[model samples]
Target: MSWEEMLTTVQESLITYWDGLVGSLPKLGAALFLIFLTWGAVTLARAFIRKLGSKTRMRKNLTDVLSMLAGTGLWLMGTLIALAIVFPSITPGKALTTLGLGSVAIGFAFKDTFENFLAGILILLREPFAIGDHVECDDIEGQIEEITIRDTHVRQTDGQLVVVPNHLLFQNPVTVRTNRDLRRTTIICGVAYGENVDDARSVIEAAVREVDSVRNDVKDVQVFAQEFAASSINFEVTWWTGSQPLDIRTSRDQVVAAVKRALDDAGIEIPFPYRTLTFNEPIPVREQGAQDEAA
Candidate 1:
């Protein structure tokens, strides 16, 4: 074709395409408006869920989890709405396929974390131990301070805070000392062998009773004649105290002090270990030269 004819044809084609684009501008604006509405709705729903979660009976961990899930749901919904508005041809099946492919890698990356998360959730639901309860697990003894979605925080007796993964906690044997109404503590005391055992036992029992914090429901303070030691008579004084954080330590100190005072008053001695050594007079050793000269 001639150059002039080709130029005229290109101009007509451009004019027609521009007219079609102008016609669709209103539809595009409406689609954008719909996307904005969907976003606002999702945001409102997330806010409402967060508010309700804080006020509900759910535990702190569960509340956090639920709020996260609600927010994620809103995000996913808003994403889908925007996708539908902008690209009506794309289907959810493609999104599912993409997610399935990514899920395997994500699982491997967070395997331990996922296990702890589930374990924490189960623990929160079951509530085997509450905050401030003394517990022993796998030879690690501590008081629980908080239960989180991935770990349980325990304050050790030595004042160190430990973060234990919930999965291991579930698998191991956990001994909760203060789960009941009262926990017992035993302070073993011994007196001099010459002291009367019955009198010593009575004194220890009275000391246990005098501690105002000690529980009365305890099956009597037992002062058993545990053993006959070389220096002192051993007696076991086991008594119960109310379930308080430091009740065991408090009761123990009180009982030990009282017992010492009582024994001192009665002239019963808490004897320390003693050893008596006797040495025979040795023959005088002579020097080699002196011995030789004497011979």
Candidate 2:
């Protein structure tokens, strides 16, 4: 086609498209307004959810999830309404069908993300552990700082923060250290074989009871001669103390010191490892004077 003819056709097409856009301006405006309206509605709904969550005894993580879900639903509804207003041909059912078909691909692409999300939801619902609770899972031993949709934040003993995937926590065995008010701790104390077992056991039990943190009212202290070691007799000392890690450490330290002092004062020996040498054959020796004379 000639250049002028091509130019004329392009001009006509632009004018037609422009006229169509102008004719649909009202619907476009409505769609934009609906989006804003949806935002406001979702904001109000989230606020209401937060208030409701506060009134109940639900966990903060669960409350956050509920509010997020409500917002998501409201936004989704608004998006469908806007789409329908703009196109006048789209329906919610059709939109859902399209999403269903696309979701397969999306799920495959983000498999781990979806797994963590689901695991987080289950964890929140089951209440296995909560924020500020001390837990040990796999190699992570720390207090739970926060629980989110993708990961859990743990503050380790040394103040290092660890981000753990929710799925790993759900699948693995988690030890909730602070689940109760008291936890049992054991210390192995060894005395010289010559010391009286009964005497040593009494001394250890008494020393453990003297510790401030040890629970004496419960009468949970136990000291038994567990086994004979290479150099000493071992006493398995067990007691009940506070459940926190710091509490356990402090109680153990106090018990060890108290036991050592008590044993020393009573003249009961806490022996060190001893070794004796044996000669398979006799060795010949010459006096220094005799060797000098021979030389």
Candidate 3:
């Protein structure tokens, strides 16, 4: 091409591009202003939802999920409006269609996260185990410390904090130890075979009733003959006490101590293991004086 012709083409192109850019500046500025307004709106919407949640006595975690959802919906609407303004060719409908495909991809990528989120919402609504309720799921034993959208914080009996995914608790069997005011606990107490069965039962029942935490008023102490061991006869002593793990431990300790004392006073023997050894052939034994001389 000729140099003059190339220069003339470049000038026309620059002028056309400059005019287009100048024309787009207003739309860009308006879109930016709209985005700022959207941010303010989102903040206000979340605050309003939280306040309403508080008034309605909703749980903290549930309120958090609701506020997050409200904010997300508002932000999406604002973003769609801004996109429409910035690029008039892309309508909200087209934007939503594109987002739908993108959302499917996102859901697949974060499958577990979404599953846990839904499980958390259901758990909060159902109110199965509240905070401070001691529960055992699978092998985990703990108190419900906190519940979030993704996981639940469990304070174990040993004072360890475990963050467990909500799906596991929702899917697995959960034993709520503190579901009721009192729980029944049993222990195997044994006495010598020579001891009278009726006397031992009476002694164990009396000892369990004497425990400070035992609920003797609500339920009578129970003592049943369980089995005969190598050295002693076992009695299953049962009583009701507080439902917490600590409460159970404390009551068990008190009951054990009280039973031991009662058994000692009644001259009842709590026998230990006994072993008998038999030799098929005789062996020669050295005298103690001969062994000492060799040492």
Q: Tell me the tens digit of each residue's lDDT in model 2 across 43-143.
A: 99989988988888788889889888889999999999999998877988899899999999999999999999999989988899999899999999999
Best by TM-score: 2
Clashes of 2: 0
- Every candidate's lDDT: 0.80, 0.93, 0.91
Show where candidate 1 strays beyond 4 Å: 1-58, 77-94, 130-147, 151-171, 174-181, 193-196, 217-220, 242-245, 274-295
lDDT of 1 by residue, 210-264 (tens): 8787776555676788987777888988888876657777878888888899889
- List TM-score per model, in order: 0.66, 0.81, 0.77
Residue 114 CA displacement from its true place in model 3, Å: 3.7
Query: Which residue pairs clash within candidate 1?
Result: none
Query: Residue 169 deviation, candidate 3, in Å?
Result: 3.2
lDDT of 3 by residue, 1-295 (tens): 9999999999999999999989999998999999999999999988998899899988888888888888889899999999999999999999999999999999999999999999998998788998889999988889999998789999997889999999999999999999999999989999988899999888888888888999999988889999988888999989999998888899999999999999999999998887878899988898999999999
Show model 2 residue runs off by greater than 4 Å.
Answer: 1-37, 85-88, 276-295
Model 3 steric clash pairs? none
Measured over all alpha carbons after superposition, the RMSD of each candidate to the real structure, in angstroms, is 6.7, 3.9, 5.2
Residue 10 deviation, candidate 1, in Å? 12
TM-score of candidate 1 to 2 decimals: 0.66
Among all candidates shown, the one with the greatest lDDT: 2
